[model samples]
Target: MTMINPAGIPHGYNTPIPSEILTADRVETRIGTLEFTDGFPSDDTAAKVFDHLDFLRAVEVFLQCVPAASMEGLRAGLLDIGCDAAHKMVIADRLLDSNPLFLTGNTDTVYALAMLDLHRDGPTVVQIPPGCGPGTVNDAWFRFVTDMGAPGPDRGAGGNYLIVPPEYEGEIPDGYFVSHSPSYTNLLALRGFVVEGKTDVAKAMFEDGVKIYPLSAADARPEMEFSSFSGKEFNTIHANDRTFYNEMADVIRREPIDVIDPETRGLLASIGIRKDRAFAPDEQMCGTLADAAAVGNATARSIVFQTRDKRAYFYEDRKWKTGFVGGDYRWLDGDGRDGRNMDARTMFFYQATLNTPAMALEMVGVGSQYALTERDASGAFLQGSHSYRLTLPSGVPAKDFWSVIVYDPQTRSELQTGQPLPSRSSENNRTELVYNDDGSIDLTFSPEPPSEHRGNWIQTVPSKSWYAILRLYGPLKPWFDKTWKPHDIERI
Candidate 1:
């Protein structure tokens, strides 16, 4: 709606036009030169900016859809391992080791994993017995759907859980904990704690008690099948290549159109990743998306490995940090006073899986807490070739127990060393750890075994980079009040 004065005014308008509103003849940007004539962009300028816009949008999509791709990768990996149905699942009967390329999976607990397809099964039912540890169900986007076991409504006295899809209008039967998920594909990951350094009880409990079946088949449910994935070379880590976009496309095609918001859907569409159509981009666009993936992967790596956010640090003086920054499971910045923290979201999903309020909320002695450190004292990254020592002071504030697991920075998985499990838990390594007269425990990290602390030594590969995560199960008040803190790792 242009209202041009038929008779030109003194300065082409009734008032002088501000320079800010007018376009110059030429403008330079990081993308390239943008040329315009009388406020109209040249064809080359329009094409350049449009291409750059698509590239930027593609990068955002990669960052935003990382969770989706990760979940899809889990599903695909499970399917490859013969866990193709809801009744079939994989369990770490012995415990997870370095063989599996999982995202920061701890070696302390027995894990059970399953992929549920509500679209295929209609309504799914999960039944577990008493003594089942913490478990969670995440949507295709890795959003928290519900918790089971300790943090669940049953409070470790496990019962039946009915998970239905978003479009489900079926009757809610009594005596079941119902959860509605917006996506068809959901990941059900369960963990069972090791008691007295043994995984036999937890493994047997899952094998004997856990049952999953479609609710419609309640009268004649299929038999539950469990496969042991301990020491297996399984891959659940998402692709960092251009195939990451394909993983997102698969999830989009599998789930309903309304699974994601319109803004996210439009962003994917901008990169030709719409569910209604094929995700086949032209040759030039393919190369652009590949480059975008490289950039996105590098950004995610930086966010996880070298975060600039101070809130991630657990202590002002130490390198120990928390994975759930801002203490919000939703990844909201300042509790949503600012919108979603995009980098925070990437930081978590890039290196770890699972999203539950139990990991964020202040449950003190009830929930678990984690402190990760990639660097040692003197603000130096932990080198595999160098020797270091870490000391946990007296009165370690864990009600149940604590564990420290070493992980490779590149894979974000358990470090591949001579030891089967690249970790030492209080329960698992009680007989091995040497305690000082003052009741403090000192651990050694080096390529060679230490003479004085041979039992406390964890093998590290030379020329590699690694990190460590100190997990406190049932952390007590001292942990929250900052009265207790793990000492920084010092070079030895």
Candidate 2:
């Protein structure tokens, strides 16, 4: 049998499979199309295939959003659709082979690592071929067989080693101990390692000291004869880990740090990293804190919203007044217009409004619901507004606070104005808000503030549309299971 190169094929299939060699009858039973002979595909198989497609689709979608052509080679082979389970797996394997990390594990690990990077604040070092630049390692990229383990301690969790990128040949300086923080996971340091000519050299700092481990076999492996050494093992921490913040100080102490390239810098800024400073938490890190709030005035709009799932919902009035909602979402549009431009800002507002309550409720035990308010919809006073409101009819679970935030429809960024963007249940804003004597909440939205409830009001910008997101901390069960419905916005 001749070896068939998967990557050599345009979409991983050969034409006719050399029909002359097999009888027609035998050919039908032997190597026919995979789609015809299957029972229902299992969820696991579907998820695996979906992950592969998601990566390809994400890169394609991101390229579509950005104006650069750096990814032309990867894009050329992604046009064909997989026909069956085997075909999908084959195609996925080929794609995975192109990236070193995925060749060793499932895509979830890749996604998890990406999420860690997004949420953690720090510089992430990724291992790559000697000449490859930082652009090649993106949100979808992962590493395998690293000296460190994955970000946290679940599947092969060990230290900051796995999360940070490996040093390139001639990159490691001398006398550096490759230490990392538990929080950001990306900010790393190499102390006490010696920088020799074209190579990093080091002697055991202590009788039992740290040693370097090779991820691939091509590198030199340490033998007992080399040296007996030991040191403190690295630890992986979650976003909420208290040690994370303290570690930030240590990360900043390292000198002559390897800065990420400008392109990656721009990408980082796009994701909410402040361009003004070298070290600061990005947007994802803000979401992890209970009291943390995102920067209110940042002009960086979500340029694109990309997701693996294809299903999404959009509601619009006759005038094209629109609202959209979806999960695992990514930005596709940036212009904010309703047509085909794929507005990331609009989608971000809709998604935040839709998911925040659900997420908050999950943290508590409540169920909540959301709906777009129509011009003449009628219900209790809580149900009359054009703005969105989530209520913990049973009450919130937090010992301290909870609130709702509003966003501009076009930019998906927080609407900046004199009126407060979030309405909290705390005494500071509660007495000024419209609420039932029974303690249930109502959020008001309009061009002008309501006559009675001024504090709980969200102002709409002129010629601009808006969407509201409700965040309920320590929620009740009714909010999560969808048993409780959210009040709508009424344009008075």
Candidate 3:
């Protein structure tokens, strides 16, 4: 007996099994009736199926590109605030005011942010104030352009910076530090530190030192307009819904065709988002795009909150964590192979906007440091309704200032409670904060301010859940050496 396949191919030197015989008979019968076609099985239907699959592949690519798109939306939102490219916004009052449109906002330092529209303007000039710490100029795609402040090219002494747009080959002027941007739009964000929490003085320094204008109108440039976004409510985060695709499409139309890689542009082209062309997707395509956006948004959120990387945690026994999982600014995994680290890119852009080498640089005396924690000391998610306390040991490591800011888990922005910015700081302005005899500071987080130490408490909303970040401006050696550590948020 022999075993045979459906095609009647015999299995050597054996009696044919019943199952094999049935399979061979079925295959033989099917083959006898089989009809061969030159192309698709049905009239053009197979081609349509392939086309649909290609569309899905394009969607996945677009999903991976969400961070770039998100950066563009943020640029647009910033521009919308001032409604003018020449004008920029700055925080005026020392008091932390209303919610900022930007995500993972810090109530620690005074900020002066501007959205530059260089698509039609050609080039823009920005002047930074001397003594300002680390700040960044990021393109619309959130890619780092350059650094400003002490660790930056200016070396803590502020100077004029010329930001030339993409493909600009005009006259190269001398006397100004130059940085060429890859996108038509860029975010020029600066942080001003107040000594001993004198916010008014810091705000004044920024007002007098900072200026922005196009190179063409250098002499006749309008005075830099300063608007106070503090103590006011506004949104700066880009929508993560289907409209996010539209934002990306807008970026495509405005930016140079070569700004992004040809591969990504081709993916957008496949979905009818070519430069200068109307991106009017048909009903069927729109439905697919919406579904893709939903999945992309969810994927980004999961990456930020429930990160798979164990490296996100800093201590083995404690729950203290870092937002940058891999620890490297570039998010490289020791082996720098792939393009940019996509997971790191997604996590940063999803929560915050700026990018710079200074962010990862362990500057001993001058620069910023950050620690983020989502879970309590017991490895449980933080809830606003529950009271928690964190203790910062004396010699807090921040030479300039330090702050603890609570944020909404969903928005990743400042947690909006009765207080515009739910934070406590060690600045001189926060003179009310009480410290222990040993010099350690205790911080309380709860829906209601703690009974005895109201000044040491940060308020949280009752029904909402939140996370918090500890920002150290002008970080010191103890921070880098890990000699000084902050206790985890302990539920009380």
Candidate 4:
């Protein structure tokens, strides 16, 4: 049976599709039918479209995974995988939307909290002790506010306050503890201290029925306050990864913070810590330290932290760092002296945006694609033979950084040859790159560049199928707008 669309284009696949399968438009037609509907309203129709596009995209992706001549079985295998990928995307997207932190910046903090809940046994209390310094208070506030409930993609319940010196219990001291409801969203309780002195504080905490005494606010610091809370593990998943930092900032900027207490709320406002925006600290050192620790622990064979591209891929031989506290200064030391460190700090505010539960779901998409192409197949490329070329179209849109990376298709990790991987960006300037008259650029890949094109050429050994990833940092308008498309690799 031959099926043709209104435009007379053939739609049927060269390989026979199951009879139960309907065309994307639901119009019954024979083989080769190609109908273009305005849009798909049903999941079935959308699935068909996604499946078709995914198959086409997989063809190009798979070509980079294995040798072209031996791709027949591999191609079939990928087709099955692509179908699954389509379904996964749909399910994942749905999961993301339903998550309380989906479009919010609280994702990573929430995820880390969830991980802690999963790994650690027993009930967790997010304590805001009295007398914590500004930084410690801020850190505790962010963590508690972000993660305090069921610990899933959805915003869990907020913590309940065990406010020291209950409102009815006479004049509160200058130092008091505040607790927020763990069950409600945006719940907070402020404990005040009317009387001064450690003994007085301790008595008030005990007699007034408080679990912990607030540290002296004047002497409070992140390290000092965090130290007091022993035994409970602290997971810093958002601090180190640049991608998470950027995303968190975006989420914070969007969600409005509702502070029921006027004095505390005003205090937050005076410091420029707006409820709808990110923390006031110009540099989010603690979060950065946390991120570095996570990356360090996760680091495997190689860890490449790309600030410009806002992506870090780590491969480690052993279990990497997970929960992080203190030692933040060590990570900063490696960050150059240039104002770059400050810039990284500004980037930290955005971590909440990228580390959400929905973001975890998105990882499903990236991971599946990564795993599929990295598997070793009979048709996989050998050590060296073919040359690959990727051409960046004009007007590539990226703000902070952009780069293309080659991954060992079989390993799915960064290809670690003696030489640094091939990359072109503002960060790694190829002075010898030959720019076209129009100002566009071309990158050539081969084991050996033609003598004249050596400057713009990257080496690729024969027979090894490799995958390419185009990374875009900062605002993604240009890439999202389709004004720019990732370079396509072609064999010479």
Candidate 5:
């Protein structure tokens, strides 16, 4: 049959138009059917597509802005603990244990942390104590600002460092390592290594030598007060629900306009989360946002627990995976040839905190290295009900030390059990670990007591799932060269 157009040209006098270029009267998709009239979508179809588009943007927003939301959550947690000012520091005086809900925090180092607001204080001065381990400053979006101690310009001798805001054009002062940050709020974190399996020396070093104050009051700085958050029950993990969007929105409002790129700004704006306007979504939008959050959370969890990317694995046959995929701190693919590695960024930020170049491209025998595994040798999720054993080869390949920590799959924080620390460290020993005859170490995990190697057993809660991370402080050449491999956790 021939169809007549409004223009009245005789059947368009041309070859038959391909149906691909035209909208059909009815089309079916994952979101049901869409109806159209002469290439124009029906009202119902338009509504469906609009709702679906919002859902997609929200999910992507959750993935891309996790770094920002996580940072905000940390800030709020610290504020609740009275570490509100730069002068007030939260120090893990007894070493970080399972009590505090910190993301992937190990039980190996004494941590001293302070939150800095560049907006309130134009520039801040941080005095790192000598013998400080890895110290980092991350900006509002969790981007690296600077390193202060061992991996920093100070080279472990400790030095005074100045951190300035993005727009600060103040007079540059000499005799201090200075770095400018693009965001208003920054996280100042310093780790103090345990000296000979005790935290007293590291705690004293941080309490007596470390100082932080606004650059304006260089003459007279406020007295630094340390609060021990070691055994405290606190939460720093971001929400996986719709409340996550609010956290991101708060960060956007507090930070500068250019803190995020235009594309990201537009994405957030589409979801009624702009920096300038109130994020008051309508009832319908609210429901959509909730659904989006659930799906986004599931997607992120999948990326962390069962990543499909081959690059995430450390070896061809090993389940040990590096969280910092692509070995680029910036998440650039193909060395920036292919844009950002979205999966890599989502994987790292979802499970960890404190992003810096040292996390990725550290030299051998310098920075730390980590390998995470949630699966057994048979490729099943690590279940708390079952018993498992992980054996490390004789030469563990850590110049400074090595440790393994268990974490709750739900919170991505330390797993809480009868043990307070939930880890076995070679140097920062919370408990003794029995070594094999050939110097190999066998670590056990189970809900019940293991018959032997009780000292090496890290308890797991029944009916709960968990994962483990192997940390190598001062990683040596064997680690980088892949000569020393970790055995997969085998079900016993």
Candidate 6:
């Protein structure tokens, strides 16, 4: 007796069947069985298959660029709240609340966020605060337009800067650091350090210092309005469905066609989005696009948290990770020979917004740095009910400031608990943080505040999983040299 396949085929692998009996009518089929391998029945069927594949390919490209798309959506949302180009949104109260307004937003500093549409407002002027850490100017695509503070032209002292819109051939003004923007819409974000956790001092700086308006209306410009968004719930993440494609279409229609690469433009065209044309997809095409968007979203999420490449991990023995897994901001491999790394792009966008070459470069004493982790030292995903501890060595590597912020793994936004801001930082208010003899400080994560180290603890919720980001505002040489490394979180 011999074991036989359920399909009534011969038991041995070497057995052969008669070709005549292989006809479709005589063969039993299952879910994955190929009913017809000869080819598609008609040209229409072949064309439809090709179109769906192309649609999916375009979706892959779209998902890879979600960071830029998400930044655009945030700008739009800000505009919706207040249409004035000169207005700014700042955290009015203690710290930034657990809102989906921005990804990995820091509560350690008072943020003055300005959204501008130069196409409508013409040339705009931005006033930067001196000594403010890292302020950034990004365009519609979230491409880095300029940096403010120590590394910027302002050099940590306040200065007036002018930004001319695309296609603006106006007179180049004198005595001002000028930048020509490549996109019509722009984002101006200023991070002001607070004194001893007194946000009022930082908030005042924004109110008295920051200004933005059309150059022509400088004298009569409306006073810069500051809106406090503390404790508010809003969305800043881009949609992962058909709405995402619509947002990209809107950006293409509003900005110059050259803002994105030609290859990207072609991909958009394949999906029925072209500059200066109505982006109307038929019902069948829309269905295919929706399915593509779902897959695209899943792809980016997988890259963000489950990346298997060894290069993604920070150390051989720790779970600390970097969003730019390749160590280069531009996603270039160490050899610099391989083409763009799509997984790196996906990781960045899924976790944060904005893109700039400065982030990719290694600055000796200045510039920003980031570390992300979703797991504990035991190589297990973080659980809300579990308490954990992390230790920051005596000589923390941040020349400016360091913050450990907890974020919801799903939204990539601040993790909401009883506390508004689920973070602890080496800023003004945390001055009393007890440090060890060697200067190492311990931080705790638990639903209930720690019995002793209250200042060094971040609150966690009991029902939600979370991740964290360690931001070094002005990363020092030790960080770059790998001489100073923060210990991973361990279960208490």
Give Cα-based local distance difference scores for all models: 0.89, 0.29, 0.76, 0.31, 0.90, 0.77
| Maximum-lDDT candidate | 5
Worst 10 residues of 4 by lDDT: 105-114
Candidate order, lDDT descending: 5, 1, 6, 3, 4, 2
Q: Which residue window of length 10 is worst by lDDT in model 6? A: 25-34
- Residue-level lDDT tens digits of model 1 in 102-134: 889988889999999999998999998898888
Candidate 5: C-alpha RMSD to true structure equals 2.3
Predicted structure 1: lDDT: 0.89
Put down candidate 4 lDDT per residue, 178-224, tens digits, no spaces: 43222111211222221221123422332232222122222342221
Model 2 alpha-carbon drift over 4 Å, by segment:
1-163, 166-400, 420-428
After aligning candidate 2 to the native by TM-score, how far in Å is the CA of 210 from where it should be?
A: 25
Could you give candidate 6's per-residue lDDT for residues 106-181 as a string of tens digits?
7777767778778888888887666665678888776678887766788888898888898898787787789888
Compared with the true structure, model 5 gives a TM-score of 0.96
Question: Comparing 2 and 4 by lDDT, which wins?
Answer: 4
Model 3, 284-374: lDDT tens per residue? Answer: 7777777777777787878777778677766677676676656667667665764456776677778876777776777777777888888
Write out the backbone clash pairs for model 6: 130-157, 130-158, 131-156, 149-156, 196-428, 196-429, 197-429, 394-439
The better-scoring model by TM-score among 1 and 3 is 1
The ten-residue window of minimal lDDT in model 1 covers: 1-10
CA displacement after TM-score superposition, residue 274 of candidate 5 (Å): 1.2
Structural similarity to truth (TM-score) of each candidate: 0.96, 0.33, 0.87, 0.30, 0.96, 0.87
